[model samples]
Target chain A: MTAGATDKAGISWLPGRQAGLALLLAPALVYYFVVLFLPQLEIATASLMAADGRFPVDTNFRRFVTDPFFLSILWRTVRLSVISTLLAVIVAYPIAIYLSQPWRRWRAVVAFAVITPIMISAVARSYGWVIILGPAGLLNQAITGLHLGTDPQHLLYTETGLVIALTHLHLPFMVLPITAALQQIDPSILRASRILGAGSMRTFWRVTLPLTLPGITAGATIVFCLNGSSFVTPALIGGARIPMMSFLIYQQGLDVRDWNFASAVAIVLLLSTSTIVIAHLIWSGRRQRRAAGAA
Target chain B: MSLPLTSQVFLEVEDLALSYGKSAFGLAGASFSARKGEVIALLGPSGCGKTTLLNLIAGFLVPDHGSIRVAGRSLRGVPPHRRDMAMVFQNYALFPHLSVEKNVAFGLEAHQVPRQEREPRIADALAMVGLSDSRTRYPRQLSGGQQQRVALARAMVVRPSILLLDEPLSNLDTLLRKSMREEIRQILDRTGITAVLVTHDQEEALVVADRILLMSNGKIEQIGTPEEIYERPRTEFGARFMAVENIMAGSVCSGDTAGTTVNTAIGQFKCTPCDVVTGANIKIAVRPERMHIVAATSGSQSYENRVTGRVVRSTYHGTYRRLLIAVHGMELIVHAPVSSDDSEYSGDVQLTWRPADTHVLLQ
Candidate 1:
C-alpha cells in the first residue's frame, strides 16, 4: 500500500469542499444582500412613483426632462467630469512610470506625496482650492509675479477652476492603477524590444502602451465615476454660479422637499454614468480581443 | 560594411572591465574575438562574469575600460538598437500581447524591411524554427518550448550581424534542454550566423560551441576548443569547474623531454612534460574514469604508474563499479567495469594509469 492511500480526507466537517467555500463567502454575501441590493431595490421602485400618490407616475420625469435649468446642470456636470478625467490621465502617466521603478531612491516619498491629498477631508481640500482660486489668490499673484500677466483671470467660481480641483482630487486614483500595470511588465520585454532594433520611443509606443491599457482603462473609469458623483468640491469651488447634478439632486431632495423629482434626477445621473462606463468597458474589451486576434 | 563572405573576424573585445563598487568587480580585463559565423560559448559558473561579457558585447553595458569593435570599427558609444545585434533571453521574453506572427514580425517592422519583403522573411523564419502552424497563437497560449522557438525565430528573422543567446536553454526541462542544445547547434551551423552563447553548463558549451571561454572569479581561466578545455585544462580552477575528481598537491621532482615526474604525499607520479622548473610546488589532476583497477597479480607488470591500496568502499553504478580506495595518506577513486561478483571489492586492489593521463595544473 502506498503512503498517501492510507491518509483520510481532511477537514471532517467540510466533506465536499464546495460547502466550505460557500461558508467562507457567507459574510460578504449577507452584507451585499442586506446593505446594498435591498435598499437599491426600494429606491428603484420608488423612483417610478409620483410624490402625491397620484396616477400617471411619470410626473417627476416629465418635469425634469422639460426643465432647462436642470438639463444645463446635467450638461455642465458631464462636461466638467470628462475634462477633469482626461486631465488626470494625461498628468498621471509619467508619474506612474516614475513610481513603478523600484530602484529609484525617492519612490516612497513620491508615492506619499501623490496620495497625501486623498487622506485629507474633501471639504477641507475644496476650501484650500477656494483660497488659491480666488480672484487675487496665490495663482494670480504667481501669474503677476512672473511678469506674464496683469489680466483679471476669472478662475474663481469658474468651470476651469472646478476642473482643476477635481483633477487634483482624483489624481491618485489614476496613478496607482497605471503604476501597478507598469510594474507587472517584465523588464526583459523592454530589453528585448531594444535588442530587436527599436529605440526607446518606439518601444514605448509598441510595447509599453499596449501592455498597460488595462491599467489606463481602470483608472479612467474610477476617475470619471468619482468626478461625476462628487458634490463637496463643486459646491464649494463652483458655488451658486455654476450648479451641478449633485447639487441639484441635493437642493431638490432636502431644501425643496421634492423627493420624487430628486429620485428621478438621481436615476438619470446613475444611468448616464453607467452608459458611458459600459461603453468604455466594451471598447477596451474589444480592443484587447482585437490585439489577440490580429496575431 | 562588407564582411567579405570569406568569414573574416567579426567581433573583438579588448580588455573589457566593469565594477559595481570598490570591493566588488563584475568583470576584469576580459578579451576575446569571434570569427565571422563562429559560435563562441562563454562558459562559467554563476558570478563568474560570462553574462557581463555578453552584455558588454551586446552594448547593454559599457565597459569601464577597454574597447569593443565590430568589423574593426569601435562600438564605444553605439546603442544596443543601432548595433544590429539581437539577443534571445533565457525566459524567452516573447511579446505577451502579440501572436506568434506579430512577434516574429516585430524586428522586421523595427528595421523597416518593407511591407512586401516582410511576409516572406517572417514565413521563412517561422518555418526555420518549425512554428509555422502556431502563428496565430499568443505567447501565453503556447508551451515553454514553443515560446522558446518563437523567441529564436524572432531573433533570427532580424538577420542580425551577431546573435546573442543568454543561457537560452537553461530554463528548459532536462529532456527538452538536451534536444534544444543539439537543435541550436544545428541551426547555428546551418545558417553560418556569428553567435555568442553564455551558459553555466560545461556539457552545453561542449555540445554547442566551436570554442569555450571558461571564466572564474570575474576573470578568464582559459579559452580553447571543447576537447582542449576538458582534456587539458591548464589551471586548477578550470579542472575543478570541469568536475575533475583527483587534484593532488605535489612537487616537481624531475623533468625531461619524455615526461615530468612529481612526488606527492602518497607516492611519486609521472605526467606530461611541462615548462615548470623542477622542485616547484604544483598540483596534478587525474580523472576517475581514466584510472584502472587491475587484478592484484598485475601489480608486477610494466605500468607507467602503479599503486596498491585497500578498498574503503565500493558503489554499484549499474554499468560501472566505483571503488573508493585508501592509498598511503590519501584516497583515490577508480571506475572499473562491474565485475561478475561484487563481493571481491572489499580486498586490497592494485591501480594503474598511464603517464599521459596525469595532468599538471598551472597556478
Candidate 2:
C-alpha cells in the first residue's frame, strides 16, 4: 500500500478522530455564531421591517436614501474620516522613521508616549482635547501670551476639534506598523545608496518611501475604518454643530427610540466600509502581482 | 621621507588615526597609497582594522587625524555621496524592491543623466555583467552569485574614481569563491579601475591582489607582492600568517661574510646573511614544502641544515601527504608529494634544507 493511503486508513480507523477535530474547532465556531453572526442577522432583519412590525418592508432604507439630512451626515462622516486618516499619516511617518533608528532608550520613551493616549478612556481623552481647544485653555493662553493673535479663536464644538481628536486617537495605529516595516529594512541598503551617489533626499524618495508602502496602506486602512465608525469623539467635540453618521445612528436608536431606522443606518455604514476595504485589497493585490511579474 | 607627487597616484591616505569611543588603542597612524589602475588588497585577520580603513576612505567614518586625498585633492568635509568612490558590499546589498535594470540606473538618475543616455549605460552595465536577460528580475529572484554580479554592475556603472570592496567573496562556498575570485580579478583588470579590497583569505589575496598589504592588530606588518610575501617575510607574524609552519627560536652563535650560524633546541643551523650581532636572539622560519625528507639510511648528508626525527603522524591529503615529525620533543610538520615509492617510509627520517631557504627574524 502507498504511505499516504495507509496513513489515511489508520487515521480513519481510530475512534473519535473526527470528533476530536470537531472538538478542537467547537469554541471558535460557537463564539462566532453567538457573538457576531446572531446580532448581524437580527440587525439585517430589523433593518427591513416596518415601524409597526406588521411585515418586512424597505421603509427605513427608503427614508435613509431620500432624506437629504441623512445623506449629508453620511457624506460628512466619510470626508472627516478621510481627513483624519491623512492627518495621522502625516504626523506618524516622521515618528515611525525616528523609532526605526538605532537609538534604543529614546525610541522606547517616544513609543510609550505615542501609545499612552490609547490607554486612557476615549471619553476622558475627548474631554482632554476639549480643555485644550477651549477659549480659556492652554492653546489660547499660549497664543495670547506669544502675541501671535489679538483674540482667542473658538475651536471647541467644531469639525476641526473632532478631526484633531480622532487623529490623535488613531496615531499609534499608523506609527506602529510603519515602524515595524522600517525596522525590517536592511541598513546596508541605505549605505549602498549613499555609496552609489544618491543623496539622502533621493534615497528616501526612491528607496525608503516605496519600501514602506505596505505599512502605510495597512495603517491607513485601520485608521479610516475606526474613525468612520467612531461615535464618542464626534459627539463630544463636534457638539451637534457638525453631524456624523455615527451620531445620527446613536440618536435614532437610543434617544429617539427608533431601533429599525438605527439598524438600517448601521447596515449602510457596514456596507460602505466593507466596500472600501475590499477595493483597497483588490488594488494592493494587483500591485503585488505586477511586482511579481516584473521579477 | 616623501615620494614625489605624480599624477599616477590615484589615492593616498596619510597618518590616518581613529579610536573607538575613548579607548586608547584603535587604528593609529596608518598610511598607504595606490596608483592608477592598481588593485591593493588589505589582507588581515578579523579585528585588524582592514574594514575600518576602508570605511575611512569611503567617508563613512571620518579619521581623527590625517587626510585622504584623491588625485592629489584632499577629501575633507566631503560626504560619501559627494565623494567619487563606489563600494561593493559584502552582502551584495541589492535593493529588493527594484529590478536589476533600475538598480543599476539609480546612480545615473541621481546624477541627472538624460534618459536616453541612462538607457544605453544601463544596458551596457547589464551586458558587461552578463545579466542582460535578467534585467527585469528583482534581487530576491536571483541566486547569490547572480545578485553579486548585479551589485558589481551597479557599482561599476557609476564610473567612480575609486572602487572599494569589503570581503566581496566571503559569502560564497569554497568552489564558488575560487571561481569568483578569478572572475573579479579579470573584471578589475579589464576595467583598469584603481581598487582596494579587504579580505582575510590569504589565498584570495595572493590570487586577486597586485599587491598585498598584510596587517595585524590595527597595524600594517608588511606590504609586498605575493611572491615577496611568500618567500621573504620580515616578521614572525608575517611568516606564521603565510603558513610557513616551521619556526625555530635560537640565538646567534657567529656571523661572517659567508653566512651566520644559530644554536637552537634541535641543533646548530646555518642561516643566510642577516643583520644580527653575535649573541643576539633570533628566530628562523621555513615553508613546509621546502623541506626535503629522505630515509635515515640515505647518503645525502651534505646539506647545510639537517635534523633527524621520527614520524609521529601522517595524513593523506589526496595530492600530498602531511607528516608530523617529533624532533627533540618538538613537533615539526612536513609536506611530501604523494608517490608510490615514498609511501612505505614510516619510522625515522632525515629532513634537510639549504641555508638559503632559512629566513632569519631578528625581532
Candidate 3:
C-alpha cells in the first residue's frame, strides 16, 4: 500500500518541473530561433544560388573551390588560426598556473590585467596593435634604439604582425578557462602527492597537468575559432597585402556585391569551427568514459 | 634489520606551534616522542590542534617555532618527500587516478626502488591489508572502508620510520568505524611500526591506542594508558573527558585513617581522600555504573554512602536502566543493570555505594 503511494508521489512533480523549465528557457529559445537559426537557414539557401540569382544552383561553391585566390585565403585562415592558438597556449599556460597558485593573493588583479584587452572594443584594441606594430611605432623604435634595424623596420602589414596581434587579443579567453580548471584542483591532492613521495615538479606533471587538460582543450578551441573568424585585426593591420577569409568575405559581400559567394564562405567557416569543436567534445567525452571505466 | 638497543629516538616532535591567520595556537608548544615500534594516539576534541600536529609531523605544515626530528636528526628543513614518513589523511587521500596497486607502488617509484622489487612490495602490502583480490581496483570502485584499508596499505608499503593517521576513521559510519578500527589496530600491531594517530573520538582512541595523549586548548591535558585515564584522571578536563560523571561539592565531616565522611547535599558519604586534608572543599566523582538504586522506602541497610531520593525520571536503556534521582536539590544518576532483581526499584529510590566507588577530586 505504501509502495503504491510512493510511486504516485514520485510522479506528481512532473508538471511542475516542465513549467519551471519552460519559464527559465523560453527567452533563450526564442532568441536562438530568431537570431541564429533563421540567419543560418537563409545562408544555407543563399549558398546554393548562382551569380545570375537562379535557385538550387552550385555555382557559388564551384567558384569558391576552383579559385586559387579563395583556396589560398582559406588556407591562410586555418594556418593563422592554428599558429595563434599555439602561441596563446604556450604564453598563457604559465600565466594561468601562476594565477592559480594558492598563495597568489593578487590573482584577481593579474586576471583583470590579462583580460583587459577583451573589455576594450576589438576595433580599438586592433588599432592600438596597428600603432605598436607599424614601421614608426614601438617595435621599430625599440629596434632602432638597440641598433638592430636601420631607420625603421617594415614590421607592420605582415603575417607576423597579424599573429602577434591575434595572440594578444585572444590570450585572456585562453587563460581564463585554463586558470579556472587549474583552480578546481584540491590543494590537498598536491600535498598528498608530495607526502606519497613526489617532488614538486613531478607532482605538477603527473597530477596537475593531467587534471587541467579539459581546460586547456576548451581554451584552445575558443581561441582558434575566434582567431579563425577574426576580421578587424587582420584587415586593419595587414592592409591589402594580406587577405584573410573574413576580410575577403567582407570585400565579396559589401564591396563586390557577391552575396552568394560570401554566404558560402561564411558557411564553410562555420562548418570548420563546428567540426573542430565537435571533435574536441568527442575526444574529451571518450577520455572521461575511459577514466570512469578504469576507476 | 636489527639496530642497537640505545639507537636513539625514532621520531620526536618538539615544542611545535602553528596557527591559521590570527587564530591562536592551532598547535602550541607541543612535544612528544615515539620509539621504533609504538602507537601513540593524539586524542583530543575538534579544533584542539591534533590534525595540525599530524600535519607538522608529515612535513605538510611548517611550525612557527621548535623542531621535528627523526632518528635524532633534525628535520626542520627537510621537505615532505625527503622526510621518509607516510601519512594517511582523514579523508583517505588515495590517488583517484591510480589503481590500488599503483597507489601502493608510488612511494617506491619516487625513491627509485628497482622495478622488480616494487611489484613484490606492492603485492605484499596489498595482501597484508587482505586486499590482494582488489589490487587492480581504483579507490572510487571500493567501499569507504576498503579504500581506507588501501590507504593503509599504501602508507605501509613505503616502510617509513613513522606512520601517521589523521582521524582515519572519522569519515566512516559507526559499525564500519568499529570494524575498521580493529583492522587498523591489527595492521599497525602486526607491522610494529611507530605510529601516531590523531582523533577526536575518545572511544576510538581508547580502543586502538597503546598510549593516549588527551589534549585540550593547545596543551596536553593528560597522558596515560586507557585504563589509567578512565580510573585516575589528573585534571577536571581529563575526568570529564573520560565520562566519569556524578560530581558533587562536599566538605569533610568525619575523619579516619582509612576513609573520610564528607557532608554533601546527598548527605554524608565516605570517600577515599584524593590528596585532601580533612575539612577542605572537595569535589567527588563517581561513575554512574558504580551507584546502585534501591527503594527510598526500603529497610535501612549498612551501605557506607546511602542517600534517600525520589526518582525524577528513568530511562530504559537496553543494557541498563539510567535513573535520575533528586536528592538535596541535585540530580544523581544511577545505572542499574537489568539482570539483578535488586536493581529494579524505580520511583523514590535510595542510591547507595561503598567508599571505594567514589573518586574524590581535590582540585
Candidate 4:
C-alpha cells in the first residue's frame, strides 16, 4: 500500500482518465444512437404527430388505425411478403439441400451457378425478368415455341409479377442461411440414423428437417423483410399500379412531399418487419430449447 | 427345414476377398463359419482386414470374389438394413438425438414392428444390458461403458439373423473392457444369437470367442478355437501374433522320421515335423510360457533340446519375470512365473523344453 500510494502520488495529476475511456467509445456510441436507435425513436414520435408537425396531445395513431386505405396497404405489404417468402423458401430448400451434400467439387460449381443472379445488379436482374415476363418475352416465346400454349401468356405487371421479382431477388438470402444451417449438422448423425434401421426418407423427415429449422426460420425472416420493403424490383417489374408500401412511402415523402404521412408509414413498416423478425427468432429459439431439453 | 441347434451354421463367409481399387488389397480369401449361439472373434493387428471381414458379413460391404450367406441365403445385393443383422461399432455410433430407449427401438420401428410389441422389446433389451435406469438418458449423458451397453442393447433389440460387433470393447479402458467383454458374452449367450466380433487383443479374443479367426496380410492365417490358435499355432505369423517366442530360421539337419532336428543358431533342437518336410527351409515357433528353466547340467531326465543363454535383462511384471535371453546372437523372450519357493534364475540360465512343445512352420 505504501509503494502504491507513492507511485500514485506522482501520477495523481493526470487528467481525463475517465474522459479518455468515454472519448475512445464516443464515436461508436454516437453512431449507434444517431444511425439506429435515434432514427427509430424519431420515427415513432413522428408517427404520433398531427399534420401540424408536432406530436399530438391525443393518440394520432388513430389515422393509421381508422383508415381502410392504410389498412389495405399494410395488408398488401404483409400478403406480398408472406407469398414471396413462401415461394423463396419452397424454391431455395431443395437447392440448399443439394448444395449441402458431400460432393464438394460439384457443390462449389453448383453453388456458384445458383447464386450467379446475385452477382448481377438488382436493376439489371429485374430487367432480365422483364424480358422474360413481357408478352413477346423469351418465356412466352418458349411456351408458344413448344406449342404448350395457344397464345402468349399475360404474365407481367401484376401481384404475381411482383412476387416473382421479390422471390428471385431474395432467393440467395433463403438458400444461404439454410445451407449454413444444414452444413452444421454432423454427417455421422445421418449415417448413424441410417444404420439404426431408418430408411433414407424417414431419417430426413425425423432428423434433417427439424435440425435445420433454425436456418429455415432465418432464411424466411430475411426473405420476408426484403419482400416487405421491396421497391425497385417491384416498381420496375410490377409497374406503379401495384403500389407496395415502399413505393407509397417514397411517393409520399419525395414525390408528393408529405413528410409527416411518409414518416408514419415508414414507422409502421419498420415496426411490422421488426415484429416478424423477432417473432420468428423467438419461435426458432423456443423450438431449439425444447429440442435441447428433450435431448 | 432347420437343422438342430448344435449342427446349424448361422452365418457362412466363404473365400471373401475385398479390394478398394485396382491395386490395394483389403481382404484375400478369408473364409469362416459361425454356428448358432456362438461368438466368433476375428483376432488380428490393425490393417489385418479384421474389420473388412466383419463388414463383409454385416452386409455393409460386398466381396469382390466370394459370397456371404446367412441362414443359407446369399446376401449378394442385400442392403445392410435388409440383411436382418445389427452391428455394434467401435465408436458406439448411438444416435445422439435418440434416448437409450429410442435407440434400442430404432430397429423395431424400421421393421415396422407393431407399436404394442416394440415397447416391451425395448424395455427387455434395455434391461438385459442393465441400462433400464438410464433408458431416458441421451447418449452424451452416459459414460463410455454405459454407451457401449446402449449400443449392445440397440443391436440385440433387433433380434436379427446375426450380430456383428466390430471391436466394440476396444474403446473401453482395460478394467472396463474386461468386465464389458464378460457382460457382452453373457448377453449374447442369453440371447442365443450367433455373433461375430473383431478384436486385436489376444486376451479379449481368448476370453470371449468360442473360436478365434487369426488373420494376417489380408488372408486367413489360421482359424480355430483359442486353445488351437495359442497352444497349437499352425503358421509362423499366427504364432508370432499370439505372443509365441523363439521363432528361429534353420534347416533340417536330421532326416530320420521320429522328428526332424533343426540345426538352428540357438543350438540344434528337435522339432515335431507336424507340417514341415525334411531338408527344407523352415521356421520353428514356440511359446515363451511353455519354456521352462531347468538345472541343465544336473538334471537326471534327458531332454530333446537344451539351450545355454545369458539373461541380458529380466523385468518382473507382477505375475511373471519377462527374461530377454541372448542365445547364440538371438534374443528369446521367456515368460518365467514368479515364485518365492522356486530359485530365481537371474543371469546365465539354462533353458530347456520338450520337442513336442516346438511347432515347426515351413517357410
Candidate 5:
C-alpha cells in the first residue's frame, strides 16, 4: 500500500518538475531555433540549389570538390585547425595543471591572466598577435636573438602565423575546460598514486592525463570547430595568400555574389567539423567500453 | 607500545611539527612509534591534526620540524614515492580508467616488478579481497564495500613498510561500516603489516587498532591500548571523545590512600583519584554507562557512590535505557539495562556506582 502511494507521489511531481525545467529552457530553445537552426536550414536548402536555381541540385558541391583552388582552401582549413587544436592541447595542459593547484599563492592571478584575455575582442587580440608575428615582431626578434644567424622570418602572413594566432585566440576555451577537469581530480587520488610508488611524472602519465582526457577532448572539439569556421584571425594574419574555407565562403558570397556556392562551402565546413567530432566521440566511447570490458 | 617484545619498532616519528602562518601548529611536535606488525589509530575530532599527521607520515605534506624514520633510516628529504608507504584513502581513490586487476597491478608496474610475476600477484591480491570474480569491472561499477576492498588490495599488494588508512570506512553506511571495519581488522591481522589508521570514529579505533593515540588541537592527548584509553582517559578531551557524558568541574574534598571525593553542584562523589591533592580546583568526569539504576537491577551492589534523584527523562535505546536524573540541581545520566520488566520508569530513582568507575581528571 505504501509502495503504491509512493509510486503515485513520485509520478505526480515529475510532470510539474519537467514543466518547470522546460519553462527554464524555453529561452535557449527559442534562441537556438531562430538564431541557429533556421539559418542552417536555409543554408542547407540553398547549398542544394543549382546556379539556375533548380531544387535538389549538387552543382555547387561539384564545383567546390573539382576546383583545386577551393579544394586547397579546404585542406588548409583542416590542416591549420588540427595543428592549432593540437598546439592548444599541449599548451593548455601545463597551464591547467598550474591553475589547478589551490595552494599556489598567485594561482588566482594566474587564472585571471589566462581567462580574462577572452573578454578582449577577437579582432583586437588578432591585432595583438599581428604585432608579435610581424617581421620586426617579438617572435622574430626572439628567434634571431638565439644567434642561429637566420634573418627575420616572414610569419606575419603565413599559415604558421595563422596557427599561432588561432592557438592564442582559442587558448582560454581549451584552458578553462581543462582547468575545470584538473581541479575536479580528487587530490587524494594523486597522493594515493604517489604513495603507491609512482613519481610525479609517472603519476601524471598514468593517472592525471587519463583522468583529464574528457576535458581535453571537449576543449579540442571547441577549438577545432571554432578554428574551422574562423574568419577574422585568418583574414588578418594569413591574408589572401592563405585562404581558409570560411574565407572562401565570405569571398564567394559577398564579393563574387555566388550564394549557392558559398552556402555549399559553409555546409562542407560544418559537415567536416561535425564528422570529426562524431568520429572522435565514437572512438572514445568504444575505448571506454573496452576499458570496462577488459579483465 | 603494546606490541610483543620480539617485534622491532618499524615506524618512528619524532617531534614532527608544521605550523600554519606563524604561530598555530598544524602538528605540534607530534611523535609516535609503531611496531613491525602493530596497528596504531590516530583517533580525534575533525581539525585536530589527525589527517595532517597522516599526510606527514605519507610524505604528502612536509614537516616544518623534526623527522620521520622507517626501519631506522631518516626520511627527511625522501619523496612520497620513495618513502615505501601505501595509503588507502577515504574515497578509495581507485583509478576510474583501470579495471580491478589492472588497478591492483599499478603499483607493481610502477615499481618495475617483473612482467612474468605481475599476473599471479594481481590475481592473489584480488582473491584476498574476494574480488577475483569481478576483475573486469571498473571501480564505479562496484559497491562501496567492494571499492574499499579493492583499495585495501591495491594498498596491500605493494607490501610497503607502513600502510596508512585515512578514515577508510567513513564513506560507508553504518551497517557496512561495522562489517568493513571488522573485515579491515581481519585483513590487517592476516597481513601483519604495520598500519597507521586515521579516524574520528572512536568505536572504529577501539575495534581495529592495537593502540589508540587520542589527539586534540594538534597534540596527542593520550596514547594507550584501546582498553586503557577507553576506561582511563588521561584528558577531558579523551574522555569526551570516548563518549563520557558526565564531565563535571569539582574540587578535591579530601584524599587518602582509598579514593578522592570531589565536590560539585551534582554532589560529592567518591572516585578513583589520579594526580590530585585536597582543596585543588580540578575537573572530574564519569561514563554514563558506569552509573547503574539501583532499583532496575534486582540487588544493586553497595556502590561506593550513590545519589537519589528524580528521573527527569528516560530514553529507550535498543541495548540499554538512558535516563537523565536531576540530582541536587545538576543533571546526571544513568544507563539502565532493559531487564525482563522493560517498563518505562519516570520517578525518583536511586543511581549507584563504585568509586573506581568515577575517573578523576588530571587537567
Candidate 6:
C-alpha cells in the first residue's frame, strides 16, 4: 500500500518539477545576464581595441603593461590595500574579542558605533576625514596648540591619508566576522585550557586563535578586495597627488575620455583583486583539508 | 616559625562563601577536606552549589570568605594554571581543531615539557585510556564514551596534584554511564591521584566515589563514605536524596533493651536505638527495597514492625515489581523481586521490616 501511494505521488510530482524549477530560476538568470554578464562582455571587447577604436589585439594591454606611470599606480593600489587590510585586522581583533564577551550590557553600544560609518555615505565619511586631517583641521590645531610640532603636517593628499580612510571604512567588515567566529567558541573550551595549565596568552595562541582563523580569512579577503577596488575615498581624500588604479581608471574614462584605456585598467584591477581573493581561498581550503585529514 | 613535617589532608577548603549579586543561590560556608588518593564526589541536585564549589577549587571563581590549601600550602592568589590542578569538563571540551594526540599533549606543552619526553608520555596516557589506536582521530569523530576517556587521559597526563571532574558521566547513556562509572573508579585507583567529582546522580556517586559529600542549598548536609551516607543519613534531605521513600513523623514513646518505640499515624514503630528523649518528636526513614510484602493470610507472623494495607498499584519492572500500598492514609512504596509467582495482589497486604532498617534522622 505504501509503495503504491509513493508511486502515485511520484507520478504527480514528476511532470511539474522541471517547469517549476525553471519558473523559480527565471528572475535570477535574467538579472545576472542583464546586470553583470552583458556589461562585462562589453568591457572585455572594448579593452582589446586601439586608441582609434579599431580592432587591435594587444595595443591597450601592451601599453598598460609597459607604462611605468600606470605600473606604479597599480603597485601603489595593491600595496595600500594590503596595508589597510592588515591595519583593519590588527585594530578589529581586540574589539571583536571584547564584543564577544558574555556580558552584553555595553556590547550593543560599541557594535552600533562600529557599524555607524557603513550607514553613512562614503563621500560624506571621506569629507568628514578631510575636516579632521586637513591643515588647520582639529588635529593640526591641537598639535600646534600643544607645540608638539612647529608646522602643520600635510596629511590630506598622501597615500597615508588614503590608507587611513580605507582602513576606517573596512574595519567593521573585519570585526563582524571575527566576532561571529569568537562567539561560536564554547566558553568551556577556554576554561578547559586554563585548567589544563595554559595562561591567558598561551590559551589564546594555542586554542582561540587557531579556531577563529576561518573568520579572519573571510574578513581579510572581503576587506582586501573592497579596499583595492575603491575609488570614492581616494578621489575625495588623496586628491590628485596620490594616483591609485581606481583613480586612474576614473580619469581615463571620464576626464580624458579614453574608453579603451579605462576598460583595460578596470580589467586589470578586477583580475588582481580576484587573484588575491582566490589565492587566499585555495590556501585556506588546503589547510582545512589537511587538518581534517590529520584528525 | 616552624612548619609541620607531614600534613595528613591533601586538600582542604575552609568556610567558603559566595553570593550571586542579590540572589541567595550561592555557596554559603561550605567546608570539606580530602586525604591523598581519595576520590570524593560532591553529590547534590541542581542549584545546590556543587558546580560552584568545583569552580571555586579550580580557580574559575573566587570565594568571598574562604581559603583553600593543598598539601599544607595556602592557595591564595594562585591562578588555575599555576595551581597545578587538572579538570575533566562535563562536555569533554576537547580542542576540535587538534588531533587526540595534540589534545592530550596540551598540558605538557604548557608546562614546557620537551618534545622528546612529551611523545612517550602522550602515548602512555592514550594507552592508559585504551585509545592508543584512535589518537589521530578528532574528538568529533569519536563516540561519547571514547571522548570521555580521552578527556580523562588528557587530565591524567599532566600528573597534577589533584584532578577535578564536572558531571563526567552525566552525558552518557544509562548502560554506558554504568560502565564508565566503573572505568573511572578503576582509573582513579590505578593513578592514586586525589580527585573531586561533581555529580547529581546518586547511583553514580554510590558506585564511583570513595566518599560522598551530600549537599543542599549551598551547604554540606553530610559527608561520609558511600555506605555510611546511604545506610545512615543525618538529615531529612540526605535521606530523601538517598531514595528513602518512606518517612514517618512520630514522637518517642519509650526506650528499652529491645529498641526505641515511636508512636505515629500508622501505629507504633520499633526503630533502632537513637539518642532521643521520651516524648520528643522525631522523623524516621525506610528505604522502599527494605520493605517486604507478605500475604494477608499469614497471621501472627513474628516481625519487628508490620502494617496491613491495600495494594493501590503494582508495576512490573522486569527484574523487580514495584507496588504502591495505601497504609493508614499514607502511600508507601515497596519493591519486591519478580518471581514466577509474581501475580498482582489485590485487597489487603501486609508489609514487614526489621527494627534495624528504620533510620532515625535527628535533623
Per-residue lDDT of candidate 5, residues B1-363 (tens digit)? 255688888899999998776544388989999889999999998888999999999888899998999999999989999988899999999998888888899999888889998888888888988899988888888999999999999998988889999999999999999998998899889888899999999999999999999998899999999999999877788888899888889899998777888888777889785668788988887899998777754675658778889999888898998888898888988788877765535687777887888888777
Alpha-carbon TM-score of each model against the true structure: 0.93, 0.92, 0.87, 0.86, 0.89, 0.94
For each candidate, C-alpha RMSD in Å?
Answer: 3.8, 4.2, 4.3, 6.4, 3.7, 4.2
**After best superposition, candidate 1 residue A226: deviation in angstroms?**
0.9
Alpha carbon lDDT at A27, candidate 3: 100
- Stretches off by above 4 angstroms in model 6 are A1-26, A293-295, B1-7, B256-259, B296-302
lDDT of 3 by residue, B244-270 (tens): 778888887766668777888767888
Q: What is the C-alpha interface RMSD of model 6?
A: 1.1
Candidate 4 wrongly placed segments (more than 4 Å)? A1-34, A56-61, A103-105, A180-188, A229-231, B1-6, B22-25, B254-260, B295-303, B340-345
Model 4 C-alpha lDDT per residue in residues A1-295, reported as the tens digit of each score: 2568775655344465576668778999999998999987886777677667665623444676698887887888899899999999889989899898876668888788778877988888899889998899998999999999988887788788778878988899999999998898876456556666677787888778877888989889878988898788877876667677888788878898766777888888888889988988987788766555452
Q: RMSD of model 5, in Å?
A: 3.7
| TM-scores of chain A across candidates | 0.89, 0.89, 0.89, 0.83, 0.90, 0.90
Backbone collision count in every prediction? 0, 0, 0, 0, 0, 0
Error of 2 at B260 (Å): 4.2
Report the TM-score measured on chain A for model 2.
Answer: 0.89
Q: What tens-digit string does per-residue lDDT give for candidate 4 at B1-363?
A: 122556778788888999977543399888788887778899999988898888777666778889988889998987776788788888888776667787788878888899999999998998888888997787877889999999888888878778888889888999999899888878877777888899999998998888889987788888888888888788888888898877999887775557778878778898876545567788888788777776535564546788878888888898887888888789988888886744456667788888888878745
TM-score, predicted candidate 6 vs. hidden true structure = 0.94
Interface RMSD of 3: 1.3
Q: Rate the local accuracy (lDDT) of all candidates.
A: 0.89, 0.87, 0.83, 0.81, 0.88, 0.89
Compute the DockQ of candidate 3: 0.55
Best by TM-score: 6
Worst 10 residues of 2 chain A by lDDT: A7-16
Model 3 ranges with Cα > 4 A deviation: A1-30, A54-69, A94-103, A138-155, B1-8, B135-137, B250-282, B294-308, B340-345, B352-363
lDDT per residue as tens, model 1, B86-148: 999999998888889999999999998999999999999999889999988988778789989
DockQ values per model: 0.65, 0.63, 0.55, 0.30, 0.64, 0.69
TM-score of chain B of 5: 0.95
Ranking by DockQ: 6, 1, 5, 2, 3, 4
lDDT of 6 by residue, A1-295 (tens): 2567785565354347577678879999999999999999899999998888789578888899999989988999999999999999999999999899968788999999999989999999999999988998887899999999989988899888788899999999999999999999999899999989999999999999999999999999999998998888998987668888988988999999999989999899999889989999999998877667541
TM-score of chain B of 3: 0.88
